[model samples]
Target: MACLVIHGGAGTIPRASLTPEGHQAARDGLRDALRAGWAVLGQGGLALDAVQAAVVALENHPSFNAGHGAVLNAAGEHELDAAIMDGRDRRAGAVASARYIRNPVLAARRVMEASDCVLVSATGADEFAREQGLDMVEQSYFTTPLRQQHWQRAHEEKAGLLKRERTEAEKHGTVGAVALDDLGNLAAATSTGGYTYKRVGRVGDAPVIGAGTYAANDVVAVSCTGLGELFIRRGTAQDIAARILYRGDDLSSAAAAAIADLTADGAGAGLIAVDAAGAMAMPHNTEGMYRGSVTADGVLSVGIYSDDFAAVETIG
Candidate 1:
């Protein structure tokens, strides 16, 4: 069986806060990403390649917070981070605080296939991607008026000129994918632009191997989105796999347990996981999570609100 799951992010997404256009855009983006990965899997591609392809689609969509529409830091600059992993060998590669790379996930894949190191950061990561001839873009390429407004509001809030709550988009967001290929291999990938108005060089769970992304043959593949610091401290991604392997919990139960822990601490979080048996679990502690999935039967679904999950259609 082959399955693919992906998440745009998780946070306090009040239904009243989203416009009709915004909602439609999100669903469209999720569908595109799901199809992108499913296409690879349908053709019998590697799980690693499927996950990478899905994440690359999300990274390219402006509606999500990975590549093109990444959030800007307090310094008003775009800093990206991404990670990719192969479950069979536990091989992983990551880059953090990269400024110019067009798709950090692609760079992470390059690092995994081409380098001896598991992680790279900042200027070095940027330069390395350039040396590899990956697509490079100007910093301005990532900036969008929507993100600029979010940063402006946060900046005002920080200056004590305004008192307000952060919407889901401003609170935080990430894009990720996890998949099981026809060959029974599992893989996971994650990418993010961090939170609104964060410090310029801050690195989140997205670029961390075990924190935000993890995969293992016959076990599970996991990719997470949430408050990065909380996800890191809890080791959330790997925790689900441990609960299943060490504690004898089923995939759904293990995912629920990990989400319960984060919920207890008021950390809005969510994750998508697929076990080797083709079972899938998407558990979240937030009001809503932008997520989608494709089952082994090729039934594709997309959801945002907590109650919105129903098969939207079947994908070939």
Candidate 2:
């Protein structure tokens, strides 16, 4: 079995303060998560389980943005969104505008397994999670003093500055994992805390399967993170797969072209993809994106910045 995994970019990365040890720690975490999924697929686990295991490992990491270190909403609470898709059956499930669910990806999978629906909102998704006996914490459990302080600082910085870019350098809010397993199965999953100081119900591409994540056995599995508006407008994830399947582009070319197109249209985002042949690509238009992947040969590669600049390369 061959496996590949990528992240949008690790969040809260202190560029100036990052020690060599800190950088290695982040790389090791990503490598370990990829290995977790690779081990599952090596043992003949389903692609869906592989993706879930990798994402669960990331979600549990307080250093990342998906679960523990998630951003705060305008209400000063942490609302989450997530989705998962199984390409074998084209079955997908998603939750948007949710709060208190620990692993939103699992909730999305439950929705796919248990319902005839494709999308579920916060309250309804919470109901389904409750019915399934998943852990449910109170809203307060979602907040951290650090995140709250950051939200407060963002609000203070943005006060009365309407024309300023809405994003802070340190506040990327999404994380994801995608995989192509040995059985020729493909799966993708994405989760997010949304933008810092986002509105109570603001839903980004994270929970929308085709927008934030998509997979198909015929092509590849894709997961995206970054500016949501551009993803929704361009349908980035599905478009990448479409170009590969319909237009005959390879995985690397399709991913690079898709991200380049998004960047040309003024969207700052990044993507990770893996094809049936185990080819992988992770690209971003931003100054940096925390991404890494493991090839079929057990060689792990991790990178933080664009390849065009030699000074920014941190790991491989």
- What would the per-residue lDDT of candidate 1 be over residues 202-306, giving only the tens digit for each residue? 999988988999999989999999888888999988998899889989999999988898888888889999999999998987788999999988999999989
* Residue 212 local lDDT, model 1: 95
Steric clash pairs (candidate 2):
9-290
Model 2 clash tally, residue pairs: 1
| C-alpha lDDT values of all predictions | 0.91, 0.76
The regions of model 1 sitting more than 4 angstroms off are none
Q: Pick the candidate with the highest TM-score.
A: 1
- Candidate 2, poorest ten consecutive residues by summed lDDT: 307-316
Q: Which residue pairs collide, candidate 1?
A: none
